[model samples]
Target: MTRRRVLETAAFGAAALAGSRPAGAAQAPNVVFIMADDLGYADVAAYGRPDLATPHIDRIAARGIRFTQAYANSAVCSATRTALITGRYQYRLPVGLEEPVTTRFAGGLPAEHPTLPGLLRQAGYRTALVGKWHLGSVQDYGPLQRGYDAFWGFRGGTIDYFSHRGTDGKPDLWDGDLRIEEVGYATHLLGERAVRTIAASVKAGRPFFLSLHFNAPHWPWETPDDEAESRRIAGSNLRHFDGGTQATYRRIVAEMDTQIGRVLDALEANGVAEDTIVVFTSDNGGERFSDTWPFTGRKTELLEGGLRIPAIVAWPRRLKAGAISAQPMITMDWLPTLLSAAGAAPDPAYPSDGIDLLPILTGQAPERPRTFFWRYRANDQAAMRDGDLKYLKIRGETFLFDVVADPLERANLKARRPDDYARLRAAWDTWNATMLPERPDSFSETYTGGQLADHFGAGGAPTPPRPALAGEAPR
Candidate 1:
């Protein structure tokens, strides 16, 4: 047998041995990681958004834990995804910032980095990725090289949901290496693929690790139906609405939620619901929509609105039902948490920035010590959240806010808390010194005049408006 086959067989043997233990003994739970692209904290029903309903996503929180202060490492797709996969700050790698849709950056999650899937796969889980895979298009960075056994998705950040075409005007859908044109809404198709992958893994008698990354509510706002769009478009004045794009965004999110329910149903039908862990979160914060009200700024900005997002972890058998945690966790934490939960050790060579969150989730651990930092090179925005205090710098304008007291960041205390600001600045500087200079490909000079307008769209608007999904902004 080949080396890979040998490893696979050995992993199966180990799983079988573990399975022979007494019934109800703790076993590695099947992990279903569902990440929505550009979803906001207030966009779901449980988060307090009454305008839109997200019964499926809210159900995860109803059955599990809902985190109030979870954040994405960055405000954009590629950066946050890198942090999620490697359990390290994105700045530690080349091309850590968000990339344009057309350009293929050389920097991707290095093979040597211990990704969540890689660590889980080593511990006998069958891994598959459905939907977006923005890590990299280079052979070494593809899902297959990064420990996923199967990949069915696009490599770009956002694609035309209906046509499966990328922002660069090319067909971006792929099944493994071969490009495949899939008919139907992208969100629904992704869910279908996820269910199929989960069912197949169960049939093969192996625990599964499925990363269902849906690119809904991201851009090119198109939905499964027109009524959903009409409802959202009726009140919005964003230019994208000129072509009934708001309807598309609304329908896309509704469809995404529906499809999510389908995946949950599949898990229940397969008898894995009790033993499976379903994690629902977003790649970054919301954009263009008024959904992220009370929190300032949108995606691409280093503000609470762009960083703070919804995070739900549902493991009915292992966690207390209907619990909520205020622990300040970030996307990077998933790697260590998943590995620890699966009884797998993180690779020693690739030390992780994230700590095991199992303790926090299980009510064993009380808090995290480390501060969270984010730097988006393109926009020259940086933020550091330490304890209850947060310091942000945008284009050299510094501001400090006691996030605990001012969750909305409306109160700037930089003048009153000079010492605190200095300390946070020092901490940020220390962290920044450790990271390599932004990769050449990752750096972009400021756009001037009309060039900027043309790139972002006329009048600096996002190419497509944000989705009016469920959830409420921080009060």
Candidate 2:
């Protein structure tokens, strides 16, 4: 495929200072990484949303640091998860190139790839995942084989919040590859599981790393009591084509917040609160029924709304309360930050494309400017943000914006900053050259090449039957 055709397609935190545990805190801290699915940047109360309140998510920011410019490595699910798992740019791996991992895809995160959980486990920490595990569900590539000591969640992108079944019509909920049945809302169930795990780990006296990835406010957008909506989607596309309202979105986020609070309450009740590093962030930006204020674009686009996300790091022992940092953090940054906090290093062969944020978080260092790059297969979307300026291209049209000044991305500065635009565009080209090429194996054989090409839509937006989501946007 030519570079032109490639354009169309597609497309966490915290804690401080190297081993400087607060006087009364444990030397080896527990890490709780909570990631929300398809959540908008301004959706959380702390971020700028007046329409909703996410107090639990807010506490992390109010008590610790709220990152103003946090970002996901990829605008889509599986890809961001890839970067989070490996602490490297998602583009460095073939798995990251997949817009989102489709159920029909043959390959998954290779079992042997160095992962955040794997490294923590190697350093004598107990690791667990208690929510969506979209990496893959194949026997060898599942979380159990990927270094998580325990796994209890679905292995697909989105599932019916009530039925807990994926679009494939299979029981996606699993406990170490064994299908399991459970009642109640998935968000509630996963929260309870995480709390239990935290209590169990404390009782076992092992430092733990728990990834509480929520599929809330994703698709089939149901609040805890939306059983009728669940039934409504039972026979249709599990994406929930018939439902969702702003009010429903409010309740969905509220439910997620309440569940997250339950888990945080577990941390405090178990007496591990101060000795644990809790991080709350999104896997990517929000989608339909989301309010991405002060930013443009949604999940599928490489605009600020799709990439910038709400992030907070509450390491009570190592970080001061109510701190805010304008760090240009990325999803991959968590791997190094958490690893550094754990006093571990990634496997030498698989070095990180991210930097550790402990120094900046702990006030030991100053924040410096850096250029961040993004590319999605759809619309030929590519962007480069350096300091205040950004160079963007969508469907072959290139433009420049002083993003810091124009957060809405309304201005087209290509003419005035031609030199800067060319420079940054070239910078993206140079960086893109160092990454892995898109892999045919990364796509599902279930899809025809022409269909995939059409989805890439070189001519324009793909034709009808297009679900509300194409980069899936949790669409």
Candidate 3:
């Protein structure tokens, strides 16, 4: 599976990508993909956050292509991360099967499986992850062992912003594998590390791929100035439902935006800003005070709101600035897109479930007819989108909607378009049959009042009573 053969097998082929590059685009570009945990489609200013300010996150959109119909592979964290790195549907791997991999989940992303970082690193690129590694917490399944050359961040889903501790109340911050206590907000720390990495990579003369997964605007939300809140929740669990407010959420997002600007500035400072492929998006939709305007659902549910994400790719040398595309793109698509951009390709022996979006992103190609399928919680939820039609099944009821026209998903077109509904439904069934079967863990759940958390994984640890916040999306 030589690189040459991979390019030859690529649908874009080597010549197409070669033409897509700017003059002297022969050298592979550095990649900086920043993922915000649980940030929603409308959370950022570019996506219409009038009450909040996110200039830095919006800058990527201003400078490059903004994807209107972009989606994460899954509606949850670990699942989408798995798909992003593997270029495959998350359910194909056991780690992806978990809604959100935690300390309780023993299975991990096997090292043998090919990864976006692993492939790039093999192609002489430096790789580092400077934020949350929620894939798996155990030593056997850490990020470094999988693909990244270095990892500096927490290893679980949710963490205390000020104290940098997981729900287990232990120090979750780390540099590589060792626990290093840094006295600062976790988001700020992650941004600083990423900025430093960018400069170091520039000095080393190697193309770098940095995955800055910020665990901000999530639960137990605290901004850079909230040290007192950390001490207040010292005795109780780390996830305090009473902590976050719209004002606090604004500050938290602002802090994240400020750090992102710093990192982007670092790229310019290193003289690689134009050559770097900078991508920014959320791992999933927003929750608890998130502005998912014009769309309804939130993370943890298989709905348009939970799946829709705001995405921007900024590579000034290759992509046009301020371009907008409504073509549907998913998290897995990054694996192939970036790989092709770097003149690297997946191993010929193993292929990818995601399509190469480079041609479409660069305006070299038009939107192609494609269908995407999703299944979660033992088939309790299923969704598929083909062209302009979408078929969905959640909570024991089926639905059909034209997502292009009805982004809110308020209209169920099953009766109006039965043929399209049947077509998409059959499409989902056939697609689901190709992936790995859902693990029993997804189906097994314990109720907590009006909310239900930890839909999967071996979560034996006692969790705080999850009070359904009435209007918040399904937990």
Candidate 4:
């Protein structure tokens, strides 16, 4: 029998076994999706990062389902987030890119697009966003305009954690429609706000959907005093600091992990630990001090290291504990999966590129049948994964790899597997032909070369000095 037939039969069997309760029957579980910015695949202790201890993040994997072969839709923040919120490939829209900025254009997530929050709200759930909202800056593209009932975060790509100010000198912090001055670190503040929102929802006895996007360990890294002290106790070298930049970065990540623990504790305190569904992931691969070892490349490139990210889902009441699934899920899949868990049906007007992950999560389905496709317009790179084989093209060089065997993408099998390459390439060609041309404004000329330094007021100077090696001791 075909895979589809098998899945359908299994679903039926599960439903019949459930009797009064359907196979997927349950109250809409409260969803708290926590996303880290620019985190690497191997950065968390759960993923085998020996240097960094991420106990709380590791706890999520141990208590729930951990995805081994999951990936972001794009290699950069804005593009991946767009796919996540809309449940469609970002390339389908005009704003998709490896790097996107608001000042370059007036583009925003189109008003017609049906957002995840909007769908959940329609299903009688309160939705809120409590972190970065880089989809757009125009009044209409703001979180309030997009589907969220409440928004309290920044609209820019990166901001100072302490000052809550962007490089452009604008107040990146907001509470609803007004700009608010927040004192503590960005990661901690976002976490505290999330807890408060959950507490308020519990008081009202209303189900909620929260997108907690934390801009931690991204750049301009800064750590809290307590976090820095903990690192010192661990025998980390931060003395004679020489600006102590790398020390600051490591401490920032550790503290971010601590804040995540806070969120988990709050859920337990509110007596909603079992009923709430929590998902932890990153917007893209890691960069700078962040590590994505075993994977190649970083945020701006179309490599395994750049695209692959850590994804863990925890739904104690429903999903089996400590389960690990190797299914190749993507960012777009979350929308449909969460909506399904919330008992929300897909909107016919806003058809999604994602499929419901209920079958896979519940063990009713063994694997996903459809191939995954990715196209980053700004860099003109494209990739497609069919079964275990992946066809990749970056900078006009084409290659293929068996991703299952070579998750790090160390070996290329394009010459030997010409038939597989040809088929995937043809499929990609057909898919590419149907896509709309990237909108004219999507391309930015800022990072072309020396132009960036000039824009940052380096006065036509050479690149800034690199920090000393992380553990280098003074002479």
**RMSD to true structure for each model, in Å:** 6.9, 8.6, 7.2, 10.9
Please provide TM-scores, in order, for all candidate models, with all chains considered together. Answer: 0.86, 0.88, 0.88, 0.83
Query: Over the full model, what C-alpha lDDT does candidate 3 score relative to the true structure?
Result: 0.79
When 3 and 4 are scored with lDDT, the better candidate is 3
As a whole number from 0 to 100, the lDDT of residue 448 in candidate 1 is 26
Tens digit of per-residue lDDT, candidate 3, span 1-475 = 2355334333322333345446664568999999998888999999888999899888898899998888888878889999998898888888887776644566788878989988887766778899888787637788877777778988888778888878667788877778888887788888889989998878867678899999887877677777898888875556566677899999988999999999989988889999999999999877766887778767766788888888999999989998888888899999999999888888675688888899988878988877888876733678998887889986568999888899889899999988888888888888888889876544222223234343343223232213223332211
Ranking by TM-score: 2, 3, 1, 4
**Every candidate's lDDT:** 0.75, 0.80, 0.79, 0.75
TM-score of 3: 0.88
lDDT, model 2, position 199: 92
- Residues 258-300, model 2: lDDT tens digits: 9889988998999989989999999888876777789987776
Question: Lowest-scoring 10 consecutive residues by lDDT in candidate 3?
Answer: 458-467
